[model samples]
Target: MKRALLALTIVATLATPAYAVLPDEIMADPAKEARARDLSRELRCMVCQNQSIDDSEAPLARDLRLLVRERIAAGDTDAQVIDFLVARYGEFVLLKPRLNSHTWLLWFLTPLAFSVGGIALWRQARRRARTSTERDEALSNLTPDEEARINQLIATEPVSEK
Candidate 1:
């Protein structure tokens, strides 16, 4: 039983790299099939937003795989196929959106947010440090009369054992 389980585990591990491509969707031409696969890997599955069409098992992924193969069979260049998809679905179809004026904000927003947060934190630290220093200085610069009064009060006060 243990040996059977171990064999099953090995088989599953070996088969895990199998893609979501169906037999019917595969192109007869090896070159076109390979190109379709490369393009599929670059395309995003709308249903599984984080997974590429090549890896996603979603119905949308399967459709995209078939679409890519169909384009390849139609003699479309890789770039042309990508352009067609991008035109039809917008840049969101690509796993990585192209850098453009429209997307500049999306790409740069993170660093900009970090920079603003850092500046705010730095200003806060400076303000706190200044306030702390001012408080300490005020406490240390007491008048001689004040020190004398405090000493007198301490002398009169009864000491308690903790």
Candidate 2:
């Protein structure tokens, strides 16, 4: 019975919408509403940072949602609407930023950083291997007198047997 209740609860939770778009915020025209929703999904919630404006309950997200709907209703093309938001909020408003001169670093920095790190790690490993080889060579090339003294020290050490 408890398992059945848990399954029902999961189903109910999944069936619910997880958006912050209130009924009053929805457009009367379905086409405009759809466009607004699409644009909202592309925009980031300034307050929530990682969430889309459509999914965030922040006041700033709500304002952005209204602004998108207003633009759509004002007959702005999707591209124009996006451009306007980009102009106002900068590229940070875009969930997926465009690759331009200013945004090149955002798109390429991670892989470039990783490549540099990998090269550095490889050089470090090679240097350590070379150092280890040099140390072993130095130990192997000890003078005969040094070898004799080492043997003498080992022989003079007391050994206890249990």
lDDT for predicted candidate 1 compared with the true structure = 0.91
Q: Model 2 scores what on Cα lDDT?
A: 0.97
Candidate 1 error regions (>4 Å): 1-18, 28-31, 144-162
Clash pairs (backbone) in predicted model 2: none
- TM-scores across all candidates? 0.73, 0.73
Query: Candidate 1 residues 64-108, lDDT tens each?
Result: 899888888888999999999999999999888888998998889
In model 2, which regions exceed 4 Å deviation? 7-17, 28-31, 142-162
Q: Tens-digit lDDT track for model 2 on 25-83? A: 99999999999999999999999999999999999999999999999999999999999
The whole-model lDDT of each prediction reads 0.91, 0.97
- Model 1 vs truth, CA RMSD: 4.8
